[model samples]
Target chain A: MRAIVLASRPVGTPSRENFEMVEVDGEKEKLRAGQVRLRPRWFSVDPYMRGRMNDVPSYIPPFRVGEPITSEAIAEVIESTTEGLSTGDLVRAHLAWQEESVLDARFATKISSDPGMSPTYYLGAMGMPGLTAYVGLFTVGHLREGDVVFISGAAGAVGSIAGQIAKTQGNFVIGSAGSDTKIDELKQLGFDAVFNYKKSAPKDALRSLAPNGIDLYFDNVGGDHLEAAIGSLRNFGRVSLCGAISQYNSTGPTPGPRNFEGNVIRKRLEVRGFIVSDHQDERVAFERDMAGWISSGKVKVLETIYEGFSSLPDAFLGLFSGSNNGKMLVAL
Target chain B: MRAIVLASRPVGTPSRENFEMVEVDGEKEKLRAGQVRLRPRWFSVDPYMRGRMNDVPSYIPPFRVGEPITSEAIAEVIESTTEGLSTGDLVRAHLAWQEESVLDARFATKISSDPGMSPTYYLGAMGMPGLTAYVGLFTVGHLREGDVVFISGAAGAVGSIAGQIAKTQGNFVIGSAGSDTKIDELKQLGFDAVFNYKKSAPKDALRSLAPNGIDLYFDNVGGDHLEAAIGSLRNFGRVSLCGAISQYNSTGPTPGPRNFEGNVIRKRLEVRGFIVSDHQDERVAFERDMAGWISSGKVKVLETIYEGFSSLPDAFLGLFSGSNNGKMLVAL
Candidate 1:
């Protein structure tokens, strides 16, 4: 078995050399009655992984050095002491970032793959990112029809799906991306307005698109974008903070808004911070709805797949640098 | 007619010299159809009034230099040409800093003296301050029982009542006030914990009382108290921003929080900016519940009454300088 371990904590932006690939002996320790061996099929490398690498305190604990980097992935069961799962069974597991790993049967969910659609779709549109978009927008954002929604990082993983979902739900969707190409991609995906944040100031772009004011802002990249959204919010607006990718790699202070308190008072805004995992209770409904959206061609899944597992570190780092569109996944 | 007006905006804290008493001839056109003459009985002198005096953008428009300041007050309908309201009826109206004034009959709410409570109570507990406390904590904060609440400006109108309400609803109430007298008063009012913010660092005081963390924070004084509350918040904490009295009279640039973004993400907190008028729909329920609390002695209302309409400017200025306890009202 081979695994990638954290070489050292990077100062600012993490690089490929920060991760060292090492070969390790495989272990088949005495498996409990319900344990199973999982062979990596497809693994996800998301922007949130950057937070895990930092040794700072956050919502979750940071990854320690010389530890296996874990992520959500689709895996195959090579052997199982479990009753339901057997040899050659395909399942979704969190035992990722490695060639092969053993996991408890309880952590692995047996997934049925459709012949027309690739199983990778489950790690994206029907998986965590899709659920994140669904829960963060609908549940946390409290999105209403005809409400103007501005999504930050609109061309990437959760943001891409969030824009499509908001559009499908009859919202006036506006999105901001890193490049003109990504902005065009957002427009093609039915965003009513899209801006290249790299070219235009987020505040100015929002002002022109949402003249009346943004009713719901789904924030993926925090810092300046969050401040910009706060400035453009109408009275009684809702801000669903899903991520802060912009400041994730920064070692220095994240600059706050000049009128942070003023905006909160003038708008009577609700700035709620949330992670998708908080809505785990809504997963059954989420999966059924997301699956319907995918199968009916109402929602399109975009994947920027990396070729091999060894490139996982590069794929993960690409998220912080805005180098990938839609979901960034590493195939083994 | 006589009125007190702002001669000039103050640099740091307002003084009596910034205001001048002026007299005007009572030469107004007779009520054509639906106007009334209001003799203000108990006028509100709130910290929010200081915000209006400055020529700055806020939720409400700032008062012009030479124009008479207007605020929420309790008045007597001395003369009326309108239906539903009669001469000698007490009403709650928006008429401040003036001895007498003619206003539209629609702006007044006729009050009943049969309840036998003083009209001053209407300006404090049964009026705007009570409603501010109620809507801010219950409606916006969604404060649950057993939640630990930290209130800034805790001896003032909204904060004092808010602490009581949180305590009444079975929450642990910790309060920060300006002086030893105010801190002692908070203790007398049944606050679980009280600190003199003038003498103690707000963050340290709050940390000492609420070591675990604050669940609901009713912010009246912003700046340091707000930053402190952010540091003292638990995961999923709720912040109902009712006022920013600390910055109302600040001549220099207001300081921004260094770790605000970190605070938002790490705690997954909900920080809501609120202004009282937005929750006008809750007034009926508010008045009913607050009046019941007052009548039943479940809530205590403390007021600092500055005698005579001539003292309006001084009373209003007292709010920012920490001279008033509970609700500050001027009696004419």
Candidate 2:
């Protein structure tokens, strides 16, 4: 079996040299009493993976060098020794980037067996990313009806779902994306307004789009976008800091929003940073609401997938360059 | 009667030239129905007043140039035309920097009749500043017992009270101040650790003082202090952004904390910016708890008062220079 490993930590922006594909003996270890053998059907490559590559203290430990990089993945249970005793069952769990791997049965969650649904949705809209969007919007951002909501990285995995969810609640939703195609897709997804951040600065775009001021900001791309959101937010505005893809690969510390004192203090704003995993308490509600939204055509699921496992590094690298429109995934 | 007016708007830092003393007829306006004639006895000079000097949108409106600047004050009601029956009563209200003024009685809260309590305490420890510290620590920061708490501008009005309140909860309280005197004062106030930020960088001081990292930061001085607090905060840390005295006088936009993305997001921190006025709903509880704390000697009240009403502008400008050890006030 083949797996991708972190060859070395990158100095600044990561390159292909930082990752290496390695051959692993799939059948070397026997399945223990509480373990199951898995063949990953789909592997998720996200911007957060970049943080794991660095030797820094964070919520999750850094990815070990010379080991398979672990992330959320959907796999098939080839064999099982647990009480559940399931073979050919589709499960979702935090797994290594490999074609074949063994996992503790307790760590894996049995995916929805509905034949009408795509198993890939478990890695995007109905999975971690979906829960991230849901929690970031309702729990963190405090999204309310009639709120002028702004989302950065609008066409990306979490942002797309967050924007659509806000729209469902009759919010005035504005989104900023890197490409014209993403902006168009966001508009099609029922965003009140969309702008290509690559051409128009987020600050200026927000001024015209949300002429009054935004009530809530779903921040994904940090740096300039975060600054712009802070500047354009109305009094008592909220900011849900979900991710900062813009500063993830920076070599040195990046300067934060200059108007933090003038705006955040004067406006009495609430800027909260959160990780989706910490909000797992909302999983039941998230899964129910998200599934309903998707089934009712309220949320349009999108993904940018790679053909094979060997393209995992490329798929991960593309996130930095805005190569993927939504969730970036690799199929086995 | 005499009043100080805004002579001109400040460019960078305010100076004596920006204020003017003018003579006014004390009896020109009659105390109408529902109004009271006030003789201001003490005036408050706060850092937030600097924001009002500029014509920017904020929770409070900007002070009109060439008009008397208004602030929290303790006034004696010499004449009352309202139904409240307030003759010889000391009341707290937002009043002008004038010897005599007529204001609606509804805006004023009658001060406690307790003979042992000083009238000046209403302008400091028993008033807005006291409520600010209480709300920032308990309501916003969600301070827990045994948590390590860091406070910037710890010798100032809000920070001093905040540190003491946290101390009462058996929390390890660390404080950073601008001068050796302030540092010594903070130590006297029962801070577990105190450092002169002028002599040592906040980041280095915090690293040595709080080796395990802090759980909550009461930020009265933003900019570098904020950056240091964010860097030193542990996972799930909370910051109560009360004021940014360091950046209040800057001509240009001051660069914010550089590690915002890395620290705030990775640590899942909550940074809440607030003004004391917004939390008036907590006044009843604040008055009860704070008065009890002060009476029991668990909280000590401190004030730096300038003599005479003529010192209003100087007292206000002194805030930017760290001229006052605690709450800066001008006594008439």
Candidate 3:
């Protein structure tokens, strides 16, 4: 079995040279009782992985050099030595970027059979990406029925779901995307307003689209988008800070939105930075609600999948370039 | 009777020349029904008043040129035609920078006298200034028993009270003031650590003082102070943004602290800006708790009283220069 390892720490933007594929000796350790051996069918290459590439302190531990990078992967159980286990069961596991993995049964969760739902959904919409959108919008953004929401990276996995959820709740949902196709897709997804941030800027687009002001801002891509949101936010507004994909590769400090603290006092705005782990208590509610939305066709999940495990680095680098429209995934 | 009026809207820092002392014809209105005539005894000059000087949209309307600057003031009911017959009664009124004011009786709350406390205490420690501190610490900051609190503008009206309150609640309170005298005053006020921000940067001071990082930041001063708090904050830390005194006079966008939004993802910090008016529902609880703290000698009030009605603008101008140690008030 082959696995991808970090060859060296990235200076600016990571490249293909930063990764090395090596064969893993899976048979070196025999499976113990309550253990399972699996073959990964699908894996995720998220923008947040860029943070782990740096050898700095963050919410999660950084990926060490010469070690296999790990993320959420949906796998098929090939062998199991645990009770009530089957050979063909589909499970979600925190495994490495490898073709095969062996771990304790406790570390993996069996994916329940859904007749029409694809198993890759476990790696994107029904997994971390889905929950990230749910927690950011409802929990952090404090979404209400009549709120005017402006979301950056609107066509991405989380933003698409967030926009649909906001529209379903009767909010005036406005979103900004990097491409004309993404903008059209967002509008088709029932977003009240959608703009291509790459062609123009969010500041002017927001001004014309939301003549009134944004009540809640869901920030995914930071920098200029963040500044526009801060400027457009109404009094007593809220912002759910998710990710700053624009600054992930910068070696030095990026000048923050120049007027961030300026409006905070005069407008009484509340800006919060959060992780999905903090709101794990809301998972039961989120899954139940998201499932209902997905099945009812009220919320849709779109994904961009890359074939083969060797294309993992390409799938990740695509995030910075805005090549992938929705959730970027790699199939093993 | 005389009153001070804003001669012109200030460009940057307001000066004594910007004010005009005008004689008021108090008898001109001829006390209508449901009205009370009051003699202003103690009027406050707060930092928030500076934001109102600019003719821009904010939480409150701007202070109009040729009009009196209005703020929280304690007055005595010298004449009244209202149902509650009162003479020489202390009351809290939303009066302008004037010697005498005629207002609807409903607008003022009659303050009951304390056995040993001075009536002017109502203008400083027991009134809006006190409530600002109380609400910012308990409701906004979510102060815990063991929280290591960093309060900027520590010797001012609200910050002084906030530091003592945090210490009384068994929290490790650190404060930053402008003067060495104020630093000594904060030490006497039970602050665990006190630094003169004028002597050195808060970034260096915080590094040595709170090497482990801070739990909560009560921001009264913005710019460098706020930047330092964000950098030194612990994971999952909270910031109760009460004021941003540093950027009040800037004509253009000031360069904000770099990399402020960067750590937010990994550290999961929450920064909320709030006005005291937003938490008015907590007034009853605040007064009950604060009165106990004051009466039991757990907290103390400090005031820098500027004598006479002609000194209103001088009292207000002194705030920016750090000439006043505690609450800057004008006595009539």
Q: Considering every candidate listed, which one attains the maximal lDDT? A: 2
Docking class of 3: medium
Relative to the true structure, candidate 3 reaches a TM of 0.98
- Among these predictions, the greatest DockQ belongs to 2
C-alpha TM-score for every candidate: 0.93, 0.97, 0.98
Share of true Cα-Cα contacts across chains kept by each model:
0.56, 0.80, 0.78
Would you list the C-alpha lDDT of every candidate in the order shown?
A: 0.85, 0.89, 0.87
Write the number of the candidate with greater TM-score, choosing between 1 and 3.
3
The sequence of per-residue lDDT tens digits that candidate 3 reaches over residues B4-101 is 88888888888887889888775756789989989888888998888888888677888888888888888999889997848788888889887778
DockQ, every prediction: 0.57, 0.80, 0.76
Mind giving the per-residue lDDT tens digits that candidate 1 earns over A236-289?
A: 899988888887777876666656776788789988887777788999998888
Model 1 residue B316 CA deviation in Å: 1.7
lDDT of 3 by residue, A74-177 (tens): 89999999975679999998989888888899999998777657888777778888899989998888898789999899888778888888888999999999
Candidate numbers sorted by lDDT from highest down: 2, 3, 1
Q: In what order do the candidates fall by DockQ, top score first?
A: 2, 3, 1
Which ten residues in a row are the worst by lDDT in model 3 chain B? B21-30
Off by over 4 Å in 2: A83-85
TM-score of chain B of 1: 0.95
How well is each residue in B78-110 modelled by candidate 2, as lDDT tens digits? 899987857889899899888887898899989
